[model samples]
Target: MVPSSHFNHIRDNTDLKLELKIPELNSQFARNSHNIPPYAQNKPPKPPNLALKISMAAKTTEAPSLSFPRDIFAALSPSPFLLAHLSPQTPSTPSIRPNGRAPSEFRKPTIHRGSLTHCSGSAVVRLGDTAVVCGVRGEILLAADIPNPPSAPPQPAATDASDADADDEDDSAELSQLSLLVPNIELATGSTPTHLPGSPPSTLAQSLTARLRALLLSTRLIRARDLRILHRAPPPPDAAATPDVPPTEEAKAYWTLYIDTLFISLDGNAFDAAWAAVVVALRDTRLPRAWWDDDVEAILCSDVPAEARALRLRGLPVAASFAVFAPGGGVGDSAFRDGQEERAWVLSDPDAFEEALCPEVVTVTVDCTGGERRVRRIEKSGGSTVGRELMKGVVQRAEERWKDWLEVFGVGNS
Candidate 1:
């Protein structure tokens, strides 16, 4: 604490000249304060005018902004996109679907019969983007080859009403019990993305086949008499002695029709298109006149085209498919609405986009050929939004669709 040499060393290290220069520095600052710019005084240098620079840059780079295409928008958000089209913002804009069709409007159907030359009968039916081709091929099914043949009915008396009734009953179940009518459906790989090449038969194809077979049997569209090949037994050697005994005719074989369907393009409403193709193809089928040849112990068919006979279809039944689109949200959130809850749209012949968004579906098959609407089948699935009133509306649409098909087939209303 009393080291004079240490104190002298510290004084030497410290700058006494710097202490004297502080006053001069303060005077220099005071002089320069008057010359300094007002923005630089008592404040950090201001940042470059960022807002002005940004405005100038924006002015140079200004251009029209591009928007997404309608197709892209629909693919991105299908439900909202469809709803926007269905429910317009202004009253002047008419509500319509994305495809520019009204909700109840069905796509026009185009049918071309006898498209395939090799098939016994063939037809190509197009309902909008959906297209189906159906072919019918007939083959002989010998009764002797059947594992369990049906019992032969007794010979009917000329005017016996009871025997006639028995014959009718037996004929009613012949096709179904014998498994004579076979239907098969194939979904082509390129027709839809879900059906890939080399894939086995899909559930959709199997279900369609089952439905077609059931309809064929239940509707009794093909009569058993047309398919039956009869052979008359020769009179016995002693028959000349008994003139009253007539030669007996027996069913030796039957014709089996294999109905095959293929989808060329499938947008939606696959079942309807498949069914229409089947009906058209069947109507165009002409089976050759066949008879049992007792000499050859085999069936023989006439080669002449004039000898071919067309099938007698009972009625022309058309199928109409519909989908219900119901948007989900709170009140006032959605553009579509009813009194309290959200509203639903019943779209007829929905396309693939609409099918993807819709959960409820209804398919009605109706026949209006008799001047009276007769419902053959009604298949509803997915949701309960379709009530009695809605079903009535669906039936009305189906009848209209039926008439449309008749017109395509060149048949006018009677």
Candidate 2:
């Protein structure tokens, strides 16, 4: 006779009720277990808490995997190329813009100033879906202690005030105002599926930084004179030496700026977004009041907010970018024969998708200072050859954009 002790006990009422329906199977299982060795029955029941802890540990130890949306997957994955041969037979729409906008039309811009209280100045700018934040900080330093000082040419003869001003301008080149102009662009997570999180800046980012630095200096957008900080110090005691010359004031201190920018969302037109952020942030920047202590020979900054002075920007240079898309073969190819309708389109301020598909791109920067506008920089790249007239048109559009932005910032009329 099989011992009932060999039967696996169904402690839960639900399990017991289910087992009651299969009495024969249950009995057989019990008889088979009785025949087995005693060692098999010695196993311990797994604790509910321990089992849960194991599952939780497994989940905790597992590394997170990268995730991308379906649309981005479609673009980056092999599916699109594999399905390319399945093109529709009928002609598609004539409008080339992905969003059905005119070729020269630009997305609306939104700007907010003083977004950061800790920074000397801060601004957030959004163009379409792209967004960026810029912050400016000022620091005081001595003239002799400035970093990377441009080698001074033989001090030109101080013939007049213009010559003195020129010398000051030369030594105090725009970048010299600060020891360094550091710019970094990070592709923030979740902003887009294309930019992977925790990745370093791309070649595109480096190119943008170099271009911005060049524009800031070449365009003289920030006046160097505004960055100068002066601290008055008493002249050294020399027993009234050189009594023939009149006593003049002595400068004991200097100052500079640190500008930082961050890209929160990127959907093409990042250059434009970053540039606008910088312009607005610089406009909002202020330098704290500081003076040199003769006893300590150190610069002392005033903590009182009332003593801060605003930095005056020399000019505002706005950048506008265009993506060139050509149908029926690449631009300037034989596909244009037989007087075929020109299918080329220059989309202004293209989003990520449009920018990726488009082969050629053109960027035009214009200076809109004191109500006068002029082209300051033009960057054209890619295989498509664009004519001078097209570039001129791009510049004209950029000027219009500058005017619109100035009005939005209350710098000029709409």
Candidate 3:
């Protein structure tokens, strides 16, 4: 039932400009951007490890309701849900996961290893309703030098394509770092039972690739200086080597390690699911030692390689998405909820059905890198407005879940 005084959306034909006069509602709609893509030029310059998806929906009630933050590009889409005030019904506390599981019943994940034999390391993981798979593959290439190499050089990793555009001659022979490729494929078939025609790859794959690559470089996980050629430098090779390098300015190594991962299948919680496989596969990686020669213009490697390194990931970014339905009278307080530490119905992960019903979706991405497994990046993604009360609940609960992960990872709780 649409409201009698339905909001007459006023958009500028030239640029799709929206103008709302309601003071309070105006404030809610005043977000910086509608929905910015990951590598958005004006976006915050940070590489995010996890991709969050949020969904929003409006109740059928005519009380004036419309979903805010629509038309998501790639990376994170809002997960949707429905909740009505029907005279304000405080839902009788339901079973923990609404699946009748005890409050402590965490989603059980099925782990499959060697899923992608063609790739370096691969695994298919399923977390109850959500499923995700990751693979790692890389070619030994010369490292790329940043336009302006840091005194501590940056890894010359390429993001766009394998046709990495780089300059190999200007590199110093002392550094040894290999560019790695971590591609993620989000399979449409993994979502529901609707038989997504298993085609020749899809949009999810491309977006995942962009998102993963951006996340890798943005974080500066691996740097070029860290890319040292063991045999290329010592008692032999000159100071000038032209090893084929990737355009990666970030090279990842041990101590503060980096793992190149790819996503294959995606069900729901791809972030958490992929992480499980990533950590395990990384534990399995064994890199080779090789160096560059500046003078002779060559990279050297030990007949029997010496040292191999792998960085211990700060931990994984467990992302959560939830949807809110029929929010804010659709007229009065028509603010959409879209913030990391704000909003409610924040699920560990959401399934497709739930996604369809939401008017506003929220995703919170957290990183638990502490030896004790801490939390980082409480990233919000709905790109909408939700009342302050609901927003608080979302943040509070997300923290709880973060702690739960630590318990499981630290205690080895099966």
Candidate 4:
């Protein structure tokens, strides 16, 4: 609404002031650019020094590299680590396990007999890091005390081979039926991480005990005659003239052996170590001469060491354990596809670390005391990597182990 003349006058004055200040502002900018400090001047950032960067990277590559320790790497990736060792890159380089043992090589066992004095017989066996102690205690069980005693076998006639054989068979049957051999296994706290303190007996312990009992009976390691206490009634005072009447002998009692096994340290292959200790302890046992006392109606064992008799073992049976490790994958996988056969290693006496990586396990018990080898038992589980041919090889290795054990027992290779 203001007058047009006033607006024009104001526009003309603004134009005049801008015209006058334009030159001055240009001059001030030119002078400031010339006098500007070197640090204050805006310059394009220098191209990154490619050569220097390359040198630094080369130096980093050449410097000593950092790596995880062998143990730590193994702990982090056990399966891959074991696979690398077992399956070496170079064919010429020998394949050795991380523990420095070759595949199929067994750990030498160390045995000390009579380690425990209180028990009738005792031994401590060590296989690699695993250690176990076995003690055998004989307790007298009177025939009368048995709830259902087995009927006595008829007396074997002299010069009758058939009757004698029948008697021997009866003895073996009686021993098995009476449950004379009892085995118990105890995995001490701290023996292994799985065995906790103050816990009841584990399934592993119970299974081991049952296996030991079965092995003992199946092998017939101990002779029944050695355990039997016989009592013969003396002929009447005036019966010397009567030669037709013979003294009648009867079995009054039997010695029941209680085999107890304790694992002090368990690395792996627990069954092998336990069974070896049992065999050694039984061999080292010496049972005192026991007899039935008719007057006191009790079983008495002689205190004299001379009267004690050592157990007669049938043969030396040794157990060997093996683990089959397949690096590619588990059983029933397509490892055999594309002409690439499955690669597996049969590790003998696998330790804790190797055992953790392995999926299949085999145990063979053999007796090589005779000229020919005898396979007493074969236990397999977990995988099909071990077939018939592989099992035969396992048996051969078991026989070799048997010989080694015989040497440990001070018996020459027979």
Off by over 4 Å in 4: 1-66, 154-172, 234-246, 330-341
Worst 10 residues of 2 by lDDT: 78-87
Tens digits of lDDT, candidate 1, 1-414: 688998888897677777888999999999888888888677786676989889989998999788999889887777778888888889898779988899999998999999999888999999888999999999999999999988876333324564345335546577888888999999887999888899889998999899888877766677776677877777789998998975666788998999999999999888888989999999999999998887898999999999999986677888889999887632222444435356788999999888888878898988887599899888888877889998999999999888888889896665
What clash count goes with each model? Answer: 0, 0, 78, 0
TM-score sort, best first: 4, 1, 2, 3
Report how far off residue 89 is in candidate 2 (Å). Answer: 14
TM-score of 1: 0.78
Candidate 2 lDDT tens digits, 1-414? 866654545346657787787998878878899687765776886657888899999999999999987567545642232122222345573443445466678888999999999999999999888988999877666766755545433222224674346433543253644544555556667777766778877777788888788777766666554554444334458737855643343334455567788888888888889888988998898888776676886778888889888865556678888887655444333434446555556778887766765678888888767666778888888856578877777778888888777776787531
lDDT of 2: 0.69
lDDT of 3 by residue, 260-368 (tens): 4444344444454555656445434444554555677655544453465443333455544454534332222234443323333444355443444444556555554
User: Relative to the unseen true structure, what is the C-alpha lDDT of residue 372 in candidate 4, on a scale of 0 to 100?
Assistant: 76
Evaluated against the true structure, the overall lDDT of model 4 is: 0.84
Return whichever of 3 and 4 wins on TM-score.
4
